[model samples]
Target: MLTLTENAAIAVKAVVAGTPDVQAAGIRIRGAEAPTAGFELTLAPQPEPADAVVEADGARVFLDSTAQAALDDQVLDAQMNEDGSVRFALAAQA
Candidate 1:
């Protein structure tokens, strides 16, 4: 299963907290059609029927089946950008 780093979970929670309409929103990972293709991430108000949900540190993440397979051993991390913005990155589990 995909996992989020502590900072990533904190960042996700902060984003959801700022969006009143998305109080119960979780990070959604939209999988690509092909194995070699890239995926996308967004804040979703709810999980899809086929989503694989992972929750930790008071934050939840919803992943499509393809994303679950692709990111089975991956980790989500957050880093500070040059402009002091937060950037999310996916890394292979070591």
Candidate 2:
């Protein structure tokens, strides 16, 4: 299963907090044609029926089928950009 780093959890929680109406909001990751090619991230009110839910440190992340498999042994991390935006990155789990 995929794991989220402390910073990633914090960042995800912060992002979800912005949506006052959606208490269960989470970041959803979806893979394109190739999982290694790239991933698309979006804020969702909740996880889909078939999504793999990963929760840590009060933060939730929903991964589609492809994303779930692709990130199975990965660690999710977050970085703050100069413009005050969060950038998500994936790294091999040690």
Candidate 3:
């Protein structure tokens, strides 16, 4: 199973709510691929920058059976340079 940071969850909820297109499209979670291990963090509308937002919730992200990988038991964070974008690297459940 996957979990979301409190702040990250809030942030994502807000973003999804605001994103008219995505909101209407319906955001979801899944694995990036068939991880040899377990999970492999994945999502639709591909989050830009792949991990770089504010608030711990900024790290909050979505995942599916496909996206969940053995992410070191936690969501690894990433960010972009030009803009402070946010995304999560979900590890599979061990």
Candidate 4:
């Protein structure tokens, strides 16, 4: 399973909180195939039926099948940018 670092959880919660009228919202990850294979992230109101839900420090993240498999042994991290944007990164679990 994928794990979220403290910073990542805080960043995810901040993002979900900033979205208006959204209940149980979280960051959703799915496999993407644009040019090169990768993953896409978005805010989702709820997890999909087949999605894998990962929560840490009250932050939620929904991952699709492909993403779940790809990130199974990974850790999610986040960093705040100068312009108040959040940047997410993935790394192998230590």
Instruction: Looking at model 3, report the run of 10 residues with the lowest lDDT sum.
Output: 51-60
Residue 64's lDDT within candidate 1 is: 95
Summarize candidate 1's per-residue lDDT along 1-94 as a digit string, tens digits: 9999999888788767766555568889998897677988888887899999888798888999989999999999987666757788999988
The full ranking of all candidates by TM-score, starting with the best, is: 2, 4, 1, 3
Worst 10 residues of 2 by lDDT: 15-24
- Model 3 stretches with alpha carbons more than 4 Å out: 21-27, 36-63, 68-84, 91-94
lDDT values of the candidates? 0.85, 0.91, 0.43, 0.91
What TM-score number comes out for model 2? 0.91
- Report the CA-based lDDT of candidate 1 relative to the real structure: 0.85
Q: On residues 16-81, what C-alpha lDDT tens digit does candidate 3 reach at each position? A: 655546542223444444455544333344444443322243333444434434332564333323
Clashes in predicted model 1: 0
- In order of appearance, the predictions have TM-scores of 0.84, 0.91, 0.38, 0.90
Candidates ranked, most accurate by lDDT first: 4, 2, 1, 3
* lDDT of candidate model 3 versus the reference: 0.43
lDDT for model 4: 0.91
Indicate which candidate wins on TM-score: 2
TM-score of 4: 0.90
lDDT of 4 by residue, 4-87 (tens): 999999999989997664457899999875526889999998899999999999899999998998899999999988788999
* Steric clash pairs (candidate 2): none
